[model samples]
Target: MSKEIRNDSECSKTDDKDWHQVTSIEQIEAAIKKEFSDESDSRKTVTAEVKNDKANWKIVLKKKNEKAEENFASEAKSLKDKIYHSRFMTTIRAQKAERFLAGAAVVLVLVVALVSVSVSTCYEVLVDGENVCYISSASELDAALKDLKAQADANTNADMTEAVLSTDVEVAAKHKVFVETASESELAEILQEKVSWQVPGAKIVVNNGESVLAFATLTDAQSVLDTLTQNAIAANSGAKVLDTRFYEDVTAEEGNVDAEDILTPEQALAQIAEGKEEVKTHTVVSGESLWSIASDNGTSVSTLNELNPGLREDRIQIGQEIKLNKIEPLINVVVDKVVTVSEAIPYGETVKESSKLMKGETQVVTKGVEGSKDVTYQISEYNGTTLEKVTLSEVVTKEPVNKVVNKGTATVATSSRSSSGSSSGVFSWPSKGTISSPYGKRGRGFHTGIDIANKKGTPVSAAAGGKVTSAGWSGGYGYCIIVDHGNGMKTRYAHLSKILVSVGDSVSRGEKIGEVGSTGNSTGPHLHFEVIVNGSTKNPINYLK
Candidate 1:
């Protein structure tokens, strides 16, 4: 018998007696014999027929009243008709068609919901409305643009006050964009290649003029200015910052530099720390030569002689006002302070003859404690350096206990090479000179060491065998060296112009170690010598013999 079939058309099969047009013997046998149940109203029953005439097969999908499903069924049936007609094929199609229709209805609903949910399909990354590329999400495009801007700001070493790369996102249900996809890193590179970033910071101006320098912050520029003013004078004086201001102009510029690229405060101070060019006159004091006056006034001997052409550089008599050129401060920072401090009145030692002690042995019978004295001082400073300190009042607070020491009176084997015999203990004279100043009270301050005034280049020797503990420029002592004799004794050689030994070198007694000169605070060439026993300064005269 001949049979016909409808593709994607509804045909009811609710009852067992209900028949199909493809009920031929071969078609009936091709369908599976089973007890089928139709319980769902949403999923209707359908039949897929098999035609023996020329081996034609057709699938009829019976679906609910749904527009999208009907449209999909018509298109699917058209495709199947072209590929399956006149082909030898057989499939048990009743149960499959019912299940396929139910699944198709659910998928159709989901597709419709999805089409409404997103009017924009792919996230289209646009640069100035020109499509760059498409990303999966709008947030991904935003993240890429944000990363690009941050990197640009960091690369330029400044803040981006204005936007140079304009970026946005666009979405559409369908768009014909033919750009390649890029990752976040690649997107940053693409944006950077297309635009330049803006650099904006503060500029430091000096002396009421426009400055070309731009620092990271206003404080940075201000620091550079303040450093220049503070050191505008000589090494001993100071200056104050004045008329300082910050200039802030935010602009989009290229080829900008970082704040660290500019010179530091120390470097800026070195360039402008010399004060204004001026000459002054200073009256000559007793025992003052051109070199001595220049050293005291922060000038060179050549400058003093040049300022006064007729004045003799070799000899300048007292009461003669010599011309001196010294750098002064731009703004003086003078400090006048009154301070009260307790001074130590050192205990005097007493020596007693003892026969029990060996000839070269000694013993301390009593320990001494330092006495205190209250003193008031008036101090004056130029810049940060102290210029003068005057004692206003003094009062003794306690009387010190005298110390007693046993002395060895027996004759001991000893040798001396010094012409002036001051050595009586364990060392010899460090230099050949008269005692210009003793190790005692001198003027307002107690002298901690003895001063030996000699010629400009007198040789200074080590007082005893010891290792040099320190050797360098010392405060108020100029070029100095300290020798640790390893027996609770240390000797110091100060106010030398040149040092011949190093810090860790070993030397014997009377070994030449330096040359005498007025390098530190002194009126003439001299050697300041000190003897320390058990970390206390003692009379150097006792160690010289």
Candidate 2:
């Protein structure tokens, strides 16, 4: 026992619910042990209540001694061991499953990564800054672009067309994920940028059916044609173009890159004019000239002239031959035009008679000469050949000279003149020189008689004994004389300066009739003689005997 404790309320009044008094220390220790008997509880505590409204409430526990700590640690270790032992097989199976799941997840991750890398490796094709298609191999993309370029080049051969064309294609590898491999055909379709132009265009023609050039559009072709025609017109006044044509032709190809071949207008025109050329021989007809022969043989007159330098326009004879080179163009550049030209005007003559001269004898007192005048003519021509001509105006540049003829009135003695038809069928040479110009074609016109060269005052002789019919000035053959013999025999002497016979006068054989001289249309002094029978002229050599 310790000591007794009393509350203030106890001194005032006693109550039946009073607290029990603590008697000894042994009792307190026993009570404490009983309260803390359970060892599983971590806390070992003791509680006390004090009386009335001012009761002291408190809870306290003793600190664990050495043995107590050891016991607690032992109990924890034992519980851990029991739990582990109870689920030993389950724990082992769970650990095995976890390992397997982790390994499978790592393998799946690796597979996914590999697939991603493979899908990312791809090729991209671009055309003119636009993404065209995707491919698997970089080589494939490059090959496709190359193939397109090759096709384009093949389509555009340099000679076939003019315009040069190309395609802009690019290829590159793109790193991507889950990209599908593109189909070859699909990729080609996507990559194709079909561009079209005149690669193999139609030809333009200039001369008749002659190819002139090639162009892309109809408009371009027409433009070339018009330009050529206009330029020719500008260079040559009144120029006419013949047989021009323009056409189109298409050579389209189904490919990525396309090219065209076009030609220049000049080249095409040259091609159309190709033809064969050769030399040929021709015989002159009765009326054929150099110009006509050239036109027939498709050659120029200059070429014919070169081949036959001796052929003359005015002196061409019958049955003459010539050589020429013939060149025929496939396309005939036949042009036509209208033009104006100038020509000469021949002068006229007037005859005046004088009574002082003899009746049959006539002399040219005044010599007549030609004059000049400008005659303007409107002419239509084809290829320089005159087709039509009309006189527009005529202007005289020089005046004409009029010829005057005098007739002598002197008469010969009757005894001197022999009887008409004195020697029958007898003839003599009319002039002294040999025959210079033969009958038929001579100068500008036909020569009706033979010409004999002699001096100016040479004696003229009669071909036969006959009576003089008449003697006077004659056209072309000035101062002409005609004689009539027995039956139908006659003789004529022309281009005489003096006449010895008159009308109704009889002349003997070998009698002089006139003197030779250059008269109207005569180039020089000569004698023109002819023999006639029954009003028909004959060669003088056959009659002279």
Candidate 3:
């Protein structure tokens, strides 16, 4: 047997008391496979050596060597297979482990980065060493600092400073509030910037965190406090707006400014006056006096009466002209000279040759001279009411002397009659009377017939022979007679006292037909005689034969 050597100390270390439990067979195999343990075990002897006779010994050695070789070869092959398999499995496990470790490391780094990015910092705002508000963003922190400084400069109270510093500030992902102090305006501005302002019809009606004044246009929405310093009305009232300054002096007098073209209260009132127009008219009513009508129409009674000259003030008729209330026109009276008279001079005769005079040729021997009567003019007085007469100059020329010439002819009241129903060629006055009113239109009515004033019971004679027709009371004619001469000629004597002829009675010229009397609506004793030819009344002066 080979010498078996072992360390007592090592053996004692492996005792039950020292090592109570074994980890695994793999652990034991590793320990036993160590170089030191393998060398020591290799040196251990097996006791009682095998026979070594020459042949027997050779055979035994050969057999043993063969078996040993077999065994060695098998053990080496098994060990080699185990080593290869185990090595491959171990390499795979190591690779998987490395991949897992790398992935875990990467996840840990991402987690650390994410945690760092989400973190924020806080800040406090100070106003003169006094805390105002807290913030968590850089931009907010800056704004807070500014607000705090302003508060300090202004010497604002704690409440006001705090109020000014409080803000709803927004933060970007990279930014955080770093201060506690922020003005209200600054905070509002920050919050406002985050929202979109491009919506249709959207009004950006806020400025510096304050609402802009509401108005139809910007020009109309200016702060009154800003204008108070310059506006006279505001100066008198002493008012301020938006915390603006107001310094008013009550001793200062109010100013007056005329705004004729402006759309203001006073201007509106003045416009009413400008739109007014003046008009005038006249109206006639019952029981209205001329004076009253004139007054109501803004005219004088005399002026109104002059337009209706026939009207009397005490005897006014309905539907008469009356003045109306209205504005009167400004009149400029101008007087101009006018000629109303004309004169003519006649040519008088003087012998131009003696032989012409011997022939007794009287050619207008007495050229009658013409004379002119004065034309009277009148000026109206009493608002052109009364007329004063003015006489125009009269013109006359001396009468020319006439030379006498004689021609022989028979003198008789009657001339020879012709075969045609002609007159004896003589004419005499039909009737004798004085004219009361001449032919024309008098005041208020037409004077259709002439008024011949005559004595009562005067003899009415026929101027020519004719047959008498029936006559009686007509509209305004009484005691009348109509005489029809044979040649479509007729005559009428109206308002007479008596009629001496009957119907179809023949009458001669110079025979009495009636007597003058006032009858049938006659105003006086007068004859209304008419001469009708071919069914028409002819003027008596034109046909008195």
Candidate 4:
């Protein structure tokens, strides 16, 4: 019996050693299972002592009641299940929190995008710090201002150097939820009515300190004066100019003026040269002459002649409209000059007694010749008209030759009497009439011949025995006849109704040539007679006998 008891104690020692060798939880569980399977002793108990660290563990075996051991195993399995459930729940909660944060960020971005789309930005225009209008864009406002300025410049008559706005204007950007913007046209219209434009100009002031004309600049005003002075100098082209100046004290004053009041240089010059005069007209009454009309209108006959060209003093009708504007220059240009001219010296006549011809007959011995002399005169003119003239000196260049003629002293028989009547002296009267118009200066023109009034179809005769040089129609002198006598002497009889003589015919003194009539610029039946010597016309009275 003693040997058996010692063997059982040794077996117990081996089991304790096996329990200390277990390192893993599986091995510990397997050992516990094996110990529990052996139900030979129901009171046998197994106890395990676990260390506090994961790397090292110690299990201590002890005997205990079967119910207590079963209860500890159940409790250990429940603790392990609780620990796994706690770790899984912690991981799930962290993932859900991360998704929630991402969703919130997306919603915030959408909200901000919607608000930005509704609100917009625009530009506001202000004048004098007062809001005038709103525009959609800044560029549109700029374009509108430019167009308004150009329109203002175009409306002005004078040149606009620069366009200035009377009020201060500005543009600024503004942010708004709702804004009413103006169109381009509307913006321009508003600005035009609200803004005032100012321009710089100049005025032309006369001696009386009154402004006669206005111009865009001072240079334009000066140009008008310079042109007026230049025209005065140019009038006396060939004369030596002494001095030229304006008659009035003209000056330029700079200031602001109305744009419509400005005048061009050409217009100003015309106004200055032609003084302000309202032209008038006069209707001639019955039995009214040009002289009477001129006297009644506070004017002169010369002025009437100047106004109406081709007007005959003796040919005016009963109902003729005559222009009565006698223009007087606003400024007179006076010029003084010394001029030399050549003048003709008429030759004298000489008579000698001879017996070579019949009684009351004459024959030429020597032809006459004219002389020339240089005459200098001091002259002063106002507005191209002679105001004063004085003779300075006269020098004879060539001497004249007197004409010599032979007169018959013997008498002729009746049968041998010349058909050409006995010629008396050098010339005779061509026609019997009363002198109407004398040969001299007549109303702005020189009368080259004298007019003789008579009844129509009256007898006309040759003044001297000579050949007819010209006959038929002549300009201004109708149905004219010219007789060429010897020694550079000729005679003309105009306004004839009939011609009884032909060209190249040798006519004697008092020979019938033509009949008087009213023709070719003549108002009545008259004879326009002229005497010419050496291609120059002389006073007919001086040579007519």
Candidate 5:
């Protein structure tokens, strides 16, 4: 029988099924071929055909029960189980790796924090086996120590010939966490305060008791004493030194001393010479005299003069520095010596009576000549001052000649009237004028003469008959003339406008020798007159007639 069948796109029962029905075997084969066209499909299928009367046919589909399908399903199920197991294992491993990385990060952060808080490398300085300070590095500590030593060497008060620290210093590296560190400058300051220096030195002890000076060495101290002795000896060069010694009981002790106390040779000598007493001085002010200065300071003018040698009482001006105290050396060097010196012997004079001349007139018969002699003296000097001098012997090398003079015994008539109507005494008035300034304490100094005021060109006469000894420009006396009378008496006429007499010219009493005028230290037209007796100044008014 022939059957006719058709495939439906959608049928109520076949639409929900995966199989389709066909009419012929070729059609059924085509349907099977079409359904299994994809070779990758593992689905198994079973086909069945149903025929009814009047040529009606239909194919039905059913699941095939094949071993291959069963094996495939079993294999697929096993493979799916394996895949799920692999995924689960991978997920677990990833989670474990993430957890380990997180733990590692935490450990790394902990390590970094520990490293930040750990002790850092530094240097520790020790002085005399005791810790002094901490610094940043060893090199820095070394530099600081060197700088401290340099500072000690540069100190002027210390003799640093072989400078060394009093205390032992050391540096070491150390790890410190929470400690204070010092900078280079601070470290140097710390070392300076903690350290001291010592040097080989000598102490000069006075009177074998107290130390007076300190030197770098014993040789230096001895040299100072030697120099002082040499200086004292040099002042008296030609003398033969008999003995030399120190007045003070001085001794030098050699030992180690503080560096600051040590001094150079020069410094030690100055200290010994300056002594222990503080020198005092006074500055002269306006209207102040040496007497007033001495009285106010509780001292004598003679003491001031002795303290300050070459100090003139009248020459002291404003702002002159006058020493009130004397400078006495701590040590006095006593030097004893013998000296021989040549001296001049003065000649003597003899008078012979004569009746042929006037009573005041005299004539020289023979000129006197000076003689020389060698004198030996024993001199004891203390610090350049001669403390004692004794003449041992004197030998005359030449005898002096005696001067013979004839004295006049005849009397002659003369005028006894002066310009002032006074008696013509031994000395007459030198000039015709009014006395202005007297021969006494005129101001701050002695005048030594009398000032006579008159008009210019007034005649200045010799006080007595004598020979002109000096006639020239004299200091402060101007164009002056001096006449030497007999019997060690002389007269001076100064501040002259003109000098008529020359040296070695003879003049009588009331003879014009010069003209009076203002010259040199004079204020106006005047004649400054003076009388000198045996090289000593006498008041002009006392001798003037």
Candidate 6:
């Protein structure tokens, strides 16, 4: 008879059944035989089929069982043994279990003992804000209080009523005291109320006390006030005190309170309380200085110094604030006339004496003194302003003298040069030359004179008729000639190769004074000329024409 066989997929089994079935090879093999056999003979052959199934199942089961056995043996062993053992894990596991339970029991007993033990606590007592630390052994809060009082001193002024104990803190060691420190303000309040009696105002105003009697006299008051102001007291306040008291005995009339008696303690306090002074602004008049402004305001230099510390040492600028200790208002003084003088007045002439004199014309030419007119002035200032007629004298004469001169007719002599002061009038330049250099600074240096570079040895003529003051070698100005042309005017000719005039000799406008040459301080042959007006060098072009 023929038979048909079914595969494992033909069965309706869950994963758990499949896994259980895999665990038993005999039951699986039996199920396979029953499901596949069809006849009696085949049924008999089922045994044979079972035997083959068993052989095939045995190989598969052997692989699965080998892995399971190795894993189970490892799990059942002690952690140490699993790391070290090859197999036979049951004995190691039992031994490991015994050790684990023994350690757990020992730890459990220790924990129970610690949890059941009773511990002693310590506390600090504060009586009236005073900390009193005490060490004691007590279980209850009330018993702890009893132990604290017994530990502290009874004679002390500490009251137990309304006392406060610190938190129930456990004793760290067998016998240890907890400490609390008293606060600063609490201690200060205690000292203030109970320690000592303080006398009011017994302490000196300044710690290293100063003296009032050291300033004994009124002079002493002035000295003290001066010292105080310099040391930082307001200067005006110091000046007020000094001005009131400094000359007390000398200035005070016999009866009432002298200036010395004015500055009492009350007055000094009042002065100090008024820290700043009244700043007085004043418009500066012409010719007014800081010292003058201070004086006009009836205040001293020191008060002005205090007012404007910005300008510590310099003169006060116009329209500045100048504080004043002018206890009384200053009286304004009015002047009826204002005359401005440019030149210095003679010894006998003053503003008063010169006030009545008038601008008179020349009468007798008694002194014949030369006087200047058309003087520049700021006279237009007081025109509409309040001023009387301000007259100024033309001249002041006390003595007079006269002289006579004899003049002869021009002698009939041709080309005869004489030192006659006939040409007293102004003269003109005798010759002309191209101006080579100007009377000023030349390249890299000062020239001091005009340079007229003419032909070498050209006759240099005088620019004006004058008496020769010098005619000689004058250092860098070799063979130079100088002429004083009267009326504080003079002329010079320098770098000359030849000089035709001698000192004290008179020359005409056309006369030859020297010959131009490259004599001294000359790059080339050139006549260096100069014009002096009133002892000062003036531009020669100004007088050339």
Clashes of each: 5, 16, 16, 0, 0, 0
Arranged by TM-score with the best first, the candidates are: 5, 4, 2, 1, 6, 3
> Candidate 1, after superposition: displacement of residue 2 in Å?
75
TM-score winner, 1 or 4: 4
lDDT of 1 by residue, 1-545 (tens): 21212221143332223223324334332221111121112222233333322222333334333544644465446423532421222122432333333322211010111121222245666666776666656677567667766766655445555544333445332321122356777766766665444334455444333224555556555676555434332332322222221222312122444423344445434433454456578998787788888898888878887677888866678899887765653334444556678899999999898754434345679987779899887766654556678898999999899898886544312332235754555677899989999999988999998999999789999876667899999988889999887656778899899999998897766779999989878789999999887778887776666
| Tens-place lDDT digits, model 6, residues 1-545 | 12233322244422323323332334434333333222211101111211122112111111112333454343223222221221222333445543433332211000000001222234433334444333332233245445444333242222333333322223222321112223434433433232221111111012122212211134433443444334322322211221112111112111212112234333433443343344456776567777787778777767777655765536555665555543321111122322333342222211221211111101221222233332222221111223234344433333222322222112111211336623322334533567789988878997777888787888898876667899888898877889876667778898888888899886756678888887877888888888776777766655564
Error of 3 at 308 (Å): 80
Residue range 1-545, candidate 4, lDDT tens digits: 00001111122221444555554444444444433332223332333333222322223344344455654465445433332233222342445433433332211000000012233467889988989999989999778777866766677556566645666888898754235689888998888777665568787877666436778888888888777667766776765555655545667778776555677787777776676566699999998999899999989999889889999988899889999985655444555666678999999999998865434457889999999999888777666567778898999999999999987554322121235644223456788889889998989999888988899998999876667899999978989999877567778999999989888887766779999998788989999988877778777766565
Rank ordering of all candidates by lDDT, starting from the highest: 5, 4, 1, 2, 6, 3
Error of 3 at 168 (Å): 99
lDDT of 2 at 299: 88
Better of 1 and 5 by lDDT: 5
Model 4 root mean square deviation, Cα atoms: 36.1
Residue 399 in candidate 6, Cα distance off native in Å: 47
Local distance difference test values of all predictions, in order? 0.58, 0.53, 0.42, 0.67, 0.70, 0.43
**On residues 417-505, what C-alpha lDDT tens digit does candidate 3 reach at each position?**
45574544222233468867654578997554455678988888765556688666676787888876545556677888887878887
Q: Give per-residue lDDT, candidate 4, residue 317.
A: 93
Writing each residue's lDDT as its tens digit, candidate 2 over 87-150 gives 3223434455434333221110100111211223677776666776678897886565556555
State model 6's lDDT: 0.43
What TM-score does candidate 5 reach?
0.44
State in Å the error of residue 129, model 6. 99
True-structure lDDT of candidate 3: 0.42
Model 5 lDDT at residue 51: 21
Measured with C-alpha atoms, the lDDT of residue 103 in candidate 1 is: 28
| Candidate 3 similarity to native, TM-score | 0.22
Error of 2 at 69 (Å): 99
Off by over 4 Å in 5: 1-150, 153-196, 208-211, 230-235, 270-281, 294-314, 323-330, 349-369, 402-545
How many steric clashes does model 2 contain?
Answer: 16
All candidates: TM-score: 0.24, 0.31, 0.22, 0.38, 0.44, 0.23
The TM-score of predicted model 4 comes to: 0.38
Which residue pairs of candidate 1 clash?
120-172, 422-545, 423-544, 423-545, 424-545
